[model samples]
Target: MKMTKRNGVFAVVLAGMIWTFASCSKDDDTIPANIEGNAIEVAQASTIAKPGTTVSVALSFADPGNGTMLVIHRDEAPLRSVPLQDGQTSYTFEDILPADLEEGDVVPYAFFIADEKNTITSDASAFEVSVALYDEITIGSSPVYQIELPEDGIIETGKVKLAAGRKYWLPHSVHFMSGTELQMEAGVELYMNTETGETYDVVIDEGARVDVTGTATAPVVVTSDKLLRDQDAEPGDWGQFNIKGEGNGSSSGHVEYLRVEYAGDRGFRLQGVGSGTTINYVQAYRALGEGIMPTDGDVRMKYLVATNCEGGGFRFGDAYAGYVQFAISQTTSFYDEVEAFTIRETASPVISNVTVVGPGEDVDDTHGMRLRANSSGKVYNSIVADFPRRGLRLNDKVTVTDLQGSTVFAYSYIFNVPRDPYRDDTENGNPFRGYLDAENVFQNPFFNNVTGFEDNDEDEPILATIDGIGTTSYIPQTVKNSAFNPASIHAFFSEANYVGAVSEAAADWTKGWVRDYEGNIHQ
Candidate 1:
C-alpha cells in the first residue's frame, strides 16, 4: 500500500509530447549534418502545477564537447538560452508559471543544443506540467489547526477525533494502520498540501475505518489547498480517500453528509466493504477517477450525487452487490464518453430512483449506463436522459445474457437518447437485448421545466434548472417487492412512487450540498 503519486519525480514521457526527431533531426536554425557534439533528452514526466508555482524539469545532456549552449523554447519560442560548461550533462530546469494561465491550458516546450556552431541536438519532449487552481485553506488559524497530529502523518493506533471550524492539511499521503479509527467531525475541511508534496491520500488499512459525521449544514469537505486567488479547482487536485476491509470495525466506514472535491483517484473508494458499513448523503464532485466506487463489497448508499466528474460517476466492479437509491450523476462540456454508471466485473447492484445525465452531442459514441463484463444489475424507478449515445448499453453477449437473467430492470425512464435507446454494442444478437426497456417510460422527465433546457448557455447549462419528475407518469405495475421489505433487503430504501431521482412532492436533497453548474459549492 505505497500510494505514491508525486509529480516531477520520475523520468517518463508525458501524454502529449512533440518529438522532433527519432534518430536525428535537422531544422532551419540548426546545422543539418556532421558536427555531432551535443545531444539532450527530457527527464521528467508530466506535472500538475498551480498558479505562481514552480514547474520543475530535468534534462540529461549527452557529450557536450567543449562549450555549448542549451536553448529552451516555450511554445516554439525561445524563452532562455543557457551556456553549459564542458561536460555538463545534467540540469534541473525550474520556471515560475504565469498566474494568468487558465484551467486545462497546456504549456509545451522543447530544447536544442548548439556546439559553438548552431546545431540542433534533441527534439522537444512532451509538454511538462499543467496549471490548475488550488484550494486556499491555510493552516494554524485556530485551536483545531493546533491539534497535535503525528509528525510523520501516520496514525498507527488509538482513535483520533478531528473537530470542526479549522483547516486540516496532509503533508503527504497519510496512512491509518489496523485497529485505528479516524473520526472527522462536522464542518471540517481536509486539504492536501500541494506546496510540500502531493498524493495526499487517506489510506485506511485492513481492519481500519473512518467515521465521518457531517450534516447538511456543516458537511465535511476534502479538497485542494491550491484554491487561492484567481485559481480554479480542478479534479485530481489531491489523491484518494480509500476505505478498505469488511468495514466491521466499530462505526468504521460510516460516512454521512461528506463532500469530496477534485480528488485525483476515487473520491471515496470502498473495497471489500460489507453490509455493516453505512453511507448517506455523500457527494463526489469533479473527480479525476471514479467519483464513488465500491469493489467486491455489499455496500449500500442513499442521496449520493457526483457531478462534472472527469471519470465515470458511480462505478461498481469486482462482483459488488450494493443498493443505491436517490442518486444522480450529471456531466457537462466533457466529450470523453465518460459514463455516469459503469457496472463491470460481474457486479450486481440494485439501483433505484436515479437520474443519469450524459455529456452533450459533441461526444462520440458513449452510454449513460454501461453494463458490461458480465455485470448484472436491477435498475428501477430511474431516468436515463439526453445521452448522445445509447441510454443503456450492453457491451457483450455475456453481459446482455446476464442482464436478462438478473432481476427487474423495469419502471424506469429513457428519454432524448438519439442513438438507439437500448443498444447491444457487440451486436451478437442476444435474445435478451431489450431487458432495460421493460415497462420503462420514454418521455421527458422534466416536463415542468421544458424552457430550461432550451438554451445551453443559461445558468443551468445542460441540466435542467430544476430537476424533478413533475408531470412524468410513474405507473408502477406492481407494489413493493417482498425482497425489499424491512426483513429481507437493506433497510435504506423507501417506497418510491416517482420515476426520477427527485420528486415533485419532496424537497431536493442536493439543495444544501453539491456543486452547481457554475462550480459554486452549495451553502
Candidate 2:
C-alpha cells in the first residue's frame, strides 16, 4: 500500500507506480497485519530529496513468513497496510518526489512488519522535501528559508536539523554541546563561513552526535558559497570539521556521501574515535592540508576518495589501528610534496584495494607511502604507482623492525618510481634496501591504459580509469595472494580479492555521483 501525504515526492512522474511487491497484494480484499512495537524494520531508506528528484528503494528481508504484513506510517500516523504471501521477499518502491514540499519540515515515515506470531519491528528516518539554496538574497528574492542559530553559536539544548530547500550560512563556528544532535537531511548543503578568511570548524563535543548523512543520489555537500558563483574556486576557504574524543569521548558521527570541498588545512580531523562511528562514500577535494586526518584511535571506513588535495590524502598517526579498503587518492603537483598515504607515530591501519596516483616524475621529494614511528599496519592487493621518490619508505629503525616482525606489507605492486623504489632512511644507510623484494611487492603490471591517466581526461572519470592494463589489475593467482578475504577480517568490510580499488570489472563505481574540480556534478 502506498500512502500519499502532502502529494509527497512520490508524485505521478515516478514511473507511474508506487511500492510494488510480487507478494504484496494490497487489494483491500486481502488481510491486514496489525503491526506495532517497531515491527517491520526499515532496513534501508532514501533520504529527503529536492523537488522533481527521482527516488527509488528496494526492500528485502529474511524469511519472516507465516503471513507477513508491512505497514507504512507517516508523521506517527497509521497510513496504509499491505498483506504479503509467505516466502515472498523482494519489493521495489520508486517514485518522483512531490514538488511542493518545504525545507525544514520533516516527513518521518516508519515501516513495521508483523510475523506469523504478530511480533513486530520497525525503523524510520525523517525525509524533508526542499528547494533552492542561495548564497545571498537581495530584496524581492524567492521565498527561501534560512537557518537561525543562537547568538552564542552553541546548540546546547535541543536538536537542530539543517534541512533541504534552504540556504544555510553559519555566521560563526557552531558547537553541538554534549547530549545535543546536529542532523542534516538529504539534499542539504551547508556553506562554510569564510567571512574573516579563518577556518570554520564544526565541533562535535563529548557526548554530542552529528548525523550528516545524505542519500546516494542526493549527497550532502559542505562547501563555501563561492563555488556556486565561480566553478574554478580556490580551496582552503574554510577550516576543519573536527570530531573530538579524548581517549574515548563518546561523540558519535554518521557521515555518508558527504563532499567536503575547499575546506582543508585539516579538512576533517578525527581523534579517539572507535567502531561505533559510520563513515562511507566520503570525498575531500582540493584540500589545503590533509584531506582526511585521523591522528589517533581506531578510525576506519571504506569508499574514500581524495583528489588533488594538499598536505596528503590520509594522514593516520598516534597509535591508530583501523581497516580501510576501496579507496582512491591522487595528486599531480610538482612543487608541493604530497604523499598518497602518510602513516606515523605507531598508526597501523590495515589497508587494501587502493589506487594511489602519486605526484609525477618532476617531483623528487615525496614518497608514495611513508611509514614510521613503529607502525605495524598491513597492505594487501593494492597498487601504488608513479611516485618520484621511493615507492615505500620506512622512516626509522623501529618501523623496519616491525615490518620484518609482526607487520605485513606484501601482495601489492609499486611502479614508475624514478629514484630508489624501496629504501630505508639515509641515516640507516639504506642497508635493508632489498627487504621489500619483487616476490612480495613487484614493479610492473599489464595496465590497460595507465598513461598517467591523461589518456581519458576528457570523456572519462579519473577514478574509474585505474582499470587493469590488460584484462585485470595484474593480480596474481587467487591462492598466491597473501591478501586474505577482507570480509573474514572484519564484518564491516566487503568480501574483496581484487588488487586495486577500481578493476576492469568493477570500474564504474565513480561514475555519476561525486563532483569534479570544476564544481560540475554527474547525474
Candidate 3:
C-alpha cells in the first residue's frame, strides 16, 4: 500500500515513538520471537544537502520472509512507503526535497520497518539544506549544488570556473593554493559582503593563478555587495584584489580588462609580480587608498586609469623595474599631502604618455607628482596640470644633480600649478627649477574639456571630461619636437608625433577599451 497522511500525523507518531523509547528500560533489548535473528541497519546520511537535489539513504537488513515493509518519515510530511522486492538484502532510497526550503533549515527524518508480527523504528537523522547565495551561478558537481568552504579559507585543489553573467557573493577572505586556478568568465561579477564589518580579499597565493580574462565589451567586475543592492555604494566598503606572484622569472598568471571599484584599500595590490605577468586595460575608481600599489616587483602595465581616489593614484615602493604607459589619473581627493603619483624608495619605473589632473586651486598643497626617497625614472611625454601646489617636488633624499644624472624627464608639460613649480629642499640647492626651465614646457595641454578644472568647490561634483579613448574634448595644442627621441624610445611605444597623453588624431590607443567613469560606458 502507498504511504499516506499529512505531515501532522507523521510528527505525532514520531513524538510518541521518541517518548516511548526514552521511557523504556535498558534491559528491554529483546526482539520478537517471530523475527528473532533478523537485523536492520541504516547507513550514515549526509550532513548537508543543497536545494533542488535528491538525498540518498541506504539500508541493509536480513529478511524474515512473512512480507516486510519500510516507511520513511520526515517531520510535518506524509510517510513514504518503500516496496521491498523478494530476496533483496539492501535498498537505497532517493529522497528529493522541496526547492523552496531556506538555506539553514534543518530537516529531520526517520525510518520504520515491520514484519507480519513485529515492527522496528530507527532513530531520527537531521540535515541542513543550503540557501542560494549567488545569482545565476551554480556550485558543486552534483545536480543539486553544495555550498562548502573549508575552515582554513583556502581552496587547496581543483579548478573552479565562475561563469559569465553571474554574481558571486564572497563572505570571507578566500585564498587559492598552488597549482590551482580560479577562472572567471567575461562579465562575471564578484561582490563582497560589507555589512560583516570585516574586510574580504581575494588573494592568489604563490603557484596559484587567477585567469580573469574579459573582453573590452564585457569586462570582469569586482565590487562591494552594497553596490549590487544599491548603486550608490561609497569607497571603503570592501577590501582589495591582491595577486601574489612568483618572483621575477615566470608569472603566476594575468588579469586583463578588469574593473575594480569602491575598494576600501588599494584597488589592486601586486606583490612580487614579475615581468612575465601582464596587467592591462584596468580601471580603478573611488578607492579609499591608492588605486594601484606595487611592492617589490617588476611590473608591466598599460592603459590604466584611476579616478576619485582619496590616496595617490599610483604608488610604487621598493625596486619596481617596469614599463607603464598610457596612464591617466583624474580628480584625486586631498588626503594629507597626497598626489596623483607617489613614487618613493628607489623605484625606477619607466612611465610615459600619462596625464595627471588635480582638484583645483582651493585644495591646499595637492601635488601632481611627489618624487621622494631617491626615486628616479624616465617620465616622458606626460602632462601634469591644475594642481594646487608644486607640480613636482624632490624630497630631502634626492637632489637635482642626482636627478640630472640618474633620471630623464623629457617632452612633458606642467601647467596651471601655483606656489613653486619645482621644490627642492634637500640642501643641494634648487637644480630642478633650472632643469624644468630647460627641458619641459609649462603650458596647458589644451584638453577637450578645459571647464573641468575651472571650479574648486568641495561640494561640487567632479566630472571626468576627457574620455582618453576617442572623441575627447582635450588635445595638446602643440606637439613638441622634443617629445620623442628616436634614439632612446622603446620599440613597444608608438612613434606618434604627439607630446601629451592624448592627440587630435582619430586613432587613439585608449579607444574601445577604456571605461568612462562618470557615464559608465566603455568608449
Winning model by TM-score? 2
Evaluated with lDDT, which candidate comes out highest? 1
lDDT value for candidate 2?
A: 0.60
Angstrom error at residue 131, model 1: 38
Candidate order by decreasing lDDT: 1, 3, 2
> Considering TM-score, which of the candidate structures 1 and 3 is the better prediction for this target?
3
- For candidate 1, lDDT tens digit of each residue in 227-299? 6323566778788888886632223468998888889868878887776788898888888888889887777
> Model 2: how far is 256 from its true place, Å?
1.0
Off by over 4 Å in 1: 1-152, 228-230, 247-251, 397-404, 426-490
Which one wins by lDDT: 2 or 3? Answer: 3
In terms of TM-score, which candidate is stronger, 2 or 3? Answer: 2
What candidate 3 gets wrong by more than 4 Å, as runs, is 1-148, 332-336, 399-404, 429-482, 485-489, 492-497, 508-519
Tens-digit lDDT string for candidate 3 (143-177)? 22222456777899976556555567676778888
